[model samples]
Target: MSTVALVTGATQGLGLALVEGLAQRLEPEDTVYLTGRDLDRVGAAVAAMPAGGAQVRGELLDVADPTAAERLAAQLKSRHGGVDVVFGNAVMRVGPDDDPRRIVRDYVEVNNFGTTRLLRAFAPILRDNARLIIVASSLGTLHHLAPSLHDRFDGPGSLDDLDHQVARWRDAVADGSARSGDWPGFVNIPSKIAQVAAVRILAADRRESDSARGILLAAVCPGMINTPTSALWWNVSDAPTPAQAANGLVDLALGPVDPAHYGELVRGGKVLPWSPASGRATVVPYAATTASS
Candidate 1:
């Protein structure tokens, strides 16, 4: 049977680039699904890809909708039997003037909750040895958070414990006290932190179940990609392009699975130490990490 790969948020930016990159490496009989919240954009993206190789199809998916993932899983099972690779790349960014409570809620809804939901819904539909890549960010490193909060994420916290921690942050936002609490003012970092931790939890669960042995699960940071989203938040133009950033993500999704690569934070094709023995430190720039692809 031919291999199948699925990429979420493939309308544009890094997600779209990942789909194209994967398609380039696929055999003629293989298939790649390009998905996004908007059907129009998804269609356009699929139409734009070069033809005559791996089959490319557009799928409409909204990660924020609680029911969307379940529906997608059913469709995948019916059509493809199971997925060989899945790129969980959909994300949401807060806007200025958005209420603090709404910001925290929205970020968690899409970035954390949506990602977990996709993983859970697809676990049964993922073939053994399947590659699951959660697109994360280096900014989500533990060093960016308060000491106590960082400890919670770095240690042996159950999925329930992680949910409890997120609830506390939501409470702080609702009460207008997030700035004074351990929760960071920016929601993106914490959301990514939750994503990375969730990967570890899910990997452990998969191992215990013994249903998906050899499944490679990892969270990868694309670094500072020069996309519309990054431009909205920063005043930088020297970052890597979306296609360049997608290289590391696509490599992890398509590369050979190794025991050392599972449940780790990969940046620019290199695995980062989650808890450094010395102390917490920030991520280096993309240019300094590895050669562009």
Candidate 2:
């Protein structure tokens, strides 16, 4: 059977680099699906890839749209039977001036909820030993949150618990109490934290369903890369190139499933400690700001 891989948000940056890296590693009979929100961008990305051994195809996917995700899953099932690897690389950033409620809702919709949607749509069809790589961020580390929040995220919680925790954060942001409640007013970090927590929950669920499949699910931080998105938040002139950062993501997706890496947050190909003890020594509190009516 030919190996099949799917990469989300593959139009450019780390996502595109991951697609190129996966293509180079795949066999001639293998296939890599490059997906993005825009058909033209996806098509252009596919066209730009070197005609390597693997067959590259473009597909339009808007992770925030559940219907789009479901449609893609159905198509993948019909054409490939199952997927061997999935790189959940799509992400959104919130601006300082954006409404707190909108920030939280939009980020959760795409980064956290959208990720779960994909996992749900593909879980049944993922091949045994399939790899699910979530492109997370170090900014989402537990160290940034209060000890109480850390416990809730790292503790043994069901998927429902995770959802409830995220929903509470959303409510806090909407009510203008996020800063006082220790919830980050911005979405980037909190969304990534939720993504990591969700991965842990999903891994446990997957294991209960089939322990022997060796299905590896992990969230990884591709150290600060000079992507357009990063440029919006920070000066990236000194940051690593997208290809350099993508190396770890591609490795985690295609490399052997190190039992240690399962359900862990990896960076620079190393698993960082996720426990409360490993959290940063100082927690920066979010400043209180009134949301515009």
Candidate 3:
């Protein structure tokens, strides 16, 4: 059987490292696609990777574009028949904002809604037992929210439900009515939370149907990486470099699926346990704001 995998937003940082790691593991006939928004960046990323027997290719795939995913899916379907693994790593993390409201909305559109769009477009093309991993954060753990809001997030909710949650956040941030603990004031936290929620819902649905596909869906929080993006919010002296972090992600992308870990937030190859009292996953830097990979 041939191996086919994809990593989105792979022009730099963790995404780039993932592509390189996958390339090392795959055989010559297998293919690993490194995708990003810019063709130039994508080409550069692909060129930089050492050929580890896999066919490393570059493609332009902006998750924010509603149609781009479908177009790529159709193309890949025609050639490879199905996708064995997919790593969603795109984000719209704002530094400083001109219009706070617009920034929040755009952030949701790119970071939250963008994930849903890829799942919708790719669902039809996933091979049996495929791995679908969204690079999320530890902040997604429900303990971060108030007790009243846990049901909306931890329960079975469709993409529409997720959108409703996103809208609620956008409106609240816009109107300056967002409470501190009720919803994280920082937009990245909520966006990552939405991503984790999406994987949980999807994994549950796959289980309910008993499709026998054995798909593994997870929103993974790769522990804080030593990168420029992380430099802004963290002291990265001990943080793993992007290459080191990619090792875990590549394992998830190609390793055996743990039934207990299905539909859960994962880190370091283990299911991230939720403690309402804690409200975040257990990590050295429990509150990481690093965007993208």
Largest TM-score belongs to which candidate? 2
lDDT of 2 by residue, 71-166 (tens): 898999999898999999887766546777656777777887788777777777889879888888886677666677776677746767777777
Off by over 4 Å in 3: 96-102, 179-181, 208-211, 274-293
In candidate 1, the residue pairs with backbone N, CA or C atoms under 3 Å apart (3 or more residues apart, or in different chains) clash, namely: none
- Poorly placed runs, candidate 1 (over 4 Å): 95-99, 151-161, 208-212, 279-293
Q: Let me know the TM-score candidate 1 reaches against the reference structure.
A: 0.87
Question: Which candidate do you rate higher for TM-score, 1 or 2?
Answer: 2
lDDT of each: 0.77, 0.79, 0.79
Candidate 3 per-residue C-alpha lDDT over 1-293 given as tens digits, one digit per residue, 9 for 90 to 100: 89999988899999888888988888998999999999998988788887567889999999888788889999999999989989999887666323445577777777887898888778778898898889999888765655556766676468778778778878887765664335555566666778898887776777744237777878899999998777766789899999999998888878887887788889987777654654543332212322221
- Output the number of the lDDT-best candidate: 2
Which 10-residue span in candidate 3 carries the lowest summed lDDT? 284-293
How many angstroms is residue 171 displaced in model 3 relative to the true structure, after the best TM-score fit?
2.4
The all-Cα superposition gives candidate 1 an RMSD in Å to the true structure of 5.8
In model 3, what are the clashing residue pairs, if there are any? 28-53, 143-279, 144-279
Candidate 2: give its CA RMSD in angstroms.
2.6
- Estimate, for each residue in 1-293, the C-alpha lDDT of model 1 and write its tens digit: 88999998888888988998889888889999999999989998999998666889998989989899889989999998999999999987665445556566777778887888887777678887788888888765676666656766666456667767766766776666765555655666677888888888777777644333677888888888887767866764999888877777777777776677678778876777665455754433222321111
CA shift of 128, model 2, Å: 2.4
Q: Give residue 271's error in model 3 in angstroms.
A: 1.2
